[model samples]
Target chain A: MKKKIICAVLIAAVILLSCCAILIQYFVGGKERIAYIYSDDKLVKTIDLNSVEQSYSFVITNSNGGSNTVEVRRGKIGVTQATCPDEICEKTGFIDSPLVPIVCLPNNLVIKISSSENENIIPDTVTR
Target chain B: MINKKIVSSIFGIILIIVLSSCNSQSVDNRAKESETDIFAMDTYMSLKAYGENSEKVLQKTSDKIKDLDEMLSVINEKSEIFKLNNANGEQIKISSDTALLINRSIEINKDTNGAFDITLYPITKEWGFTTGNYKVPTQARIDELLKYVGSENIILDNDNNLVSLNNHANIDLGGIAKGYAGRCAADIIKSEGITSAILNMGGNVQTIGAKPDGNNWKIGIQDPNDSSDIVGIVEVADKAVITSGGYERYFEDENGNIYRHIIDPKTGYPAETDIISVTVIGSDGMTCDALSTSLFVMGIEKSVEYIGTKHDYDVIIVSSDNKIYITSGIAEKFTVSSKFSEYTLNTI
Candidate 1:
């Protein structure tokens, strides 16, 4: 009698967990925040904003010379330091939205959020 | 026995639902796309066009940019523009590129009441805006250059591709060059069988057509007051959107006086106007680019009054007091950012 009760309860819990997962996947699968970093027009890195668990920093250097220091938080990315003369990329601050991209002209680097593959996504923006 | 059978059947039905739902999530297949980043014309340009011929279009654009930079650079000693500026009253045989740009600039200058003067290059150079070692020029020096700051002083024999300048005037195509480049890139893309693309040159964005899915591209105009926030979004197709704002580049003196890069041709100083930024949208990228700067100098009220009823293009002007004046032509196309609800919007 005890074994049968335990079996039924286990079956119910498994079914409930599966339902919860499908619901979560349906909501989460459509809107994805992805950032692509390009140097001299070549893509160097891609970050999934939703999955980032901790803050970190990285550096991108152009072979022709010049570098940019990128700092990443859970949902945003920014340039903290740069070898570019104006440091305009650093001044642009952190960007969470796909609309505005961070560009370091001197270093020949660009960081922009990707919305092309996000089918359910709307409102793609090009910032001035 | 009956209770156990019911529970087993329910469990089996739930498993099938889960498996079917997981399988039903579609993986979309999109059209081919080619995108590349290029640094040219003193800014980073991202060119992305869809279709199989897009790669060829990008290569052609890259080559054309190199040629354009060589021909139009005022700072490059060997550039055609430099040679003409130092021409010293002699008619230098110029390329069609120089003739076309100079002709358009003259027309814009007349139309904008000298607000779009190409001859303001000397004054701009004196302030070091081009080299970025920026400083405020003395009033006396500015006044000296002001005499040479008129497009009328430019002599162009359009029949023959020859150009000259009078009164020691110098011209720089920096303001309109990027837009023209974008326009050329667009033409190239279309010629190469790519229907949709964006030649985004820094603050200047020129689009080719609607996306493959038949949706207009959404462009965000950066807030002049706050660099990180967007003022609004504009939906566009086959249009060029260019923005000019004093806040984009400026220098501050020790006394906390700020001097901007856009030197007013009349005053020979950074434009002092009620307008903080001007964004122009039109089919012709060059016109939109020149108009953005010209309108900014015209101030919020004058711009509205100047562009009233013409409707050839649209403008979104943000004033110093944080009010937004959008042209009625693009009123439906623009949606202000919710964060900007604090400010009032007046559709012109």
Candidate 2:
């Protein structure tokens, strides 16, 4: 009876761990996190895949003397945010997907997203 | 025996359900990864439009645009109109590219009076806004350049194909040149098979086609008060959108007074108006860029009246209240979301 109980608990533990890992991979790995570029997280830029249209260009700057001009259309690329005024490195609009990063120049802020094919895999700690 | 079997089955089913749910989630996430192409440093102006073969095309196009910039710099140095070296009145021959831009400048100058003067270089230097060097100039110095800054003073002889500036005034196309380059790139891209692209030259933006899914290309207009908050999103399917804001370049005095770059030709001072930024969306990028600057200097009321006469283009103006004024047609196309809730979209 003791041996059976131990086996049951061990099996349940393995099942739970695997389930948690799968869950993390789905939620964290599949979709790129939308960057809420803000001065104080007040939702400065909503850079989610759903929100961005192909071939869109805009200038994003922060108060930190950083400014960047970003252009995204079909191909992904982010560049040219360094200007004399506010160099919000957000000028590099070149991220093709969520895996890449878009920066803000003046603010010295970096919002990173995933782009690699295996980006859907979640780590063990994060699965919880 | 029956009770033991029932308990075993129930536990097994529960475990399977939990396990399946997690497995499906992982599958769903991996399934949606979008495939995209990347164009790096090869992303010069005209090359962005060539689609798959854009890497090679971009290389060629960037070289061409850089060459154009160099040519214009040379023109700035030797043009008899600017006369950087000579104060004496002498007719100097210019390169064809410089002449073309000058001719275009002359037309805009003639049509808009001194409102769209390219010959404001001397005054621009006096204000110290051109090279990121900021300092308040004396009233006496501004007044001196103001006399020679009028676009009307520029003479364009179509017969001999020559151009001249009165009183040795200078011209600067920095405000309009990027837009022209964007338009040229758009034209080049359209010539190729690729139909969809966006030309984002600094604050000037132009769209070539709808999305790959054939939806309207949404371009967000930046809030003048807060660079992070979008004032509104403009739906530009096949058009150019350009914005000119008082916030782009400016400085604050000890008294906290703001001095901006967009100078009004009439007053020779930074345009002081309630409107914070002007975004013009039209068919041509260069036209949109020029008109946006012109309208910013013209102020809101007059600019709205001017826009009313044109049926094809649309505009959005952000005011001091953070209220957004847009054309009726544009209002119909955009969906007001939680982000723009604070902004009032007033249709002109």
Candidate 3:
């Protein structure tokens, strides 16, 4: 009976610690010039902006059945084109910093940037 | 017995993690479960709220903003403002929302002495700001349109929701409509008992209440010099932060002269001011929106004089010489970026 309880506690602790590890990875997990593209709250793709030796563009089909053409340059990311009605994501131009987020409402796409050791200081949104 | 205990313990930890991140503005909220983004009023708007009935509240907020866009948009031919502007100076019955905004705009104009005039639509249209085809109106054309530049020309019958132009004039609520939409969204969310929410309506921001942990929401001020970065961050709860900058909209003529979209109702030309960027923080989004533009047009000296310890709202401006002048109301709330630390920070 004692052995069974010890094994159960060990399993529970592993599960809890793994959850903590995920939460930590979320905040400061090897911060780099990374752009996380989420579609309907699901991370669709990750791009290291610093590693891109050349510029490239691709379309991502979203949960809304619409699609956005994401353009990745050497140091920035933007929605070059989108099937979304507003094209607000494209209008967001290019964002190289986490301060700005590129969003397409109709397509339900969100592009966020995170970088460097100053990860704790990134802002939620920027007002001009 | 051990299996049951393990199941309950793991489940409890999961619940704690979820609940703890519920109102957090950190890593998880960016991936927030209850959030919506909509494009309305010629700007992109994002709403994020936590707690009960968030989806329903967000949908309702979206509907309200769409309705406001239909009612307040000047460029939309079907909008009430468009109809009223084309009414040939005749009395028109408008919605109560329209009447209230018109009245409030006049009051702001009076307080700022015409710096926040809604009657600049005719002059704005002449400069092609209404449409994207930009141009510089001749001085004669500008001066002619400037005749109808007073908000006093807008007459409203409050009880009956009636409005009319006492003189030949046109009006546009672009300045305050977005901010009003933010206020409405916040109110709707708060009414639904969702106290923790943040909205980004284009560049304007509105917070409903404190963060879930009771900390103030941290908002960054976009660096006018670089849209990709921010100049400073302000921490606040239940307030609206609106900014007006020359870099928002502008056109360069063939001669390489750049003219921003913010026209001086007084001069009928792009406002030539000592400040290039002005931000207003207040509890009322509409007032913040109006003052952001009004202060920009008022220039730095007059803006400092105008805000003059009212304590109702605060202003932060970056002068042409790169000095930062902030009102005493938000002196402790705003922190300048290290890169911008080279500039002087003046508390007015």
Best-performing candidate as measured by DockQ: 1
iRMSD per model? Answer: 4.2, 12.1, 6.2
DockQ of each: 0.34, 0.06, 0.30
Give every collision pair in model 3.
Answer: none
Segments in model 3 whose C-alpha atoms lie over 4 Å from true places: A1-29, A32-50, A57-71, A78-93, A102-117, B1-33
State the local distance difference test value for candidate 1: 0.82
Positional deviation of B19 in candidate 3, in angstroms?
A: 18
**Per-residue C-alpha lDDT of model 2 across residues B1-348, encoded as one tens digit per residue:** 644654675577567867776563454422111122222111112123425655555455455556556545423454333452244444556556556667776666554545577777777667766655666777887887788777666666666656666786677776666666667666766666556666555556767776544666667665454443355566666787788888746766687887888888777788777778888878866667667777788778888888898777788887777677888868786555456687777899
Q: In candidate 2, how many Å is residue B188 off?
A: 1.1
Ranking by TM-score: 1, 3, 2
Q: Candidate 2: where are CA atoms >4 Å away?
A: A1-27, A30-128, B1-47, B74-89, B95-97, B110-113
Docking class of 3: acceptable
Error of 2 at B167 (Å): 1.3
List model 1 lDDT by residue over B206-321, tens digit each: 88898877889887888775555788888999999999988767767799998888878899888999988789999999888888889988888779988895578999888889
Query: What TM-score number comes out for model 3?
Result: 0.80
lDDT of 1 at B197: 81
The number of the candidate with the highest lDDT is: 3
lDDT values of the candidates? 0.82, 0.59, 0.84
Candidate 2 local lDDT, A1-128, one digit each (tens): 76567656766776677677777866666545344333322345655543456657676565654555555443344555556342324323344443224443234444434343333221100000
Docking class of 2: incorrect
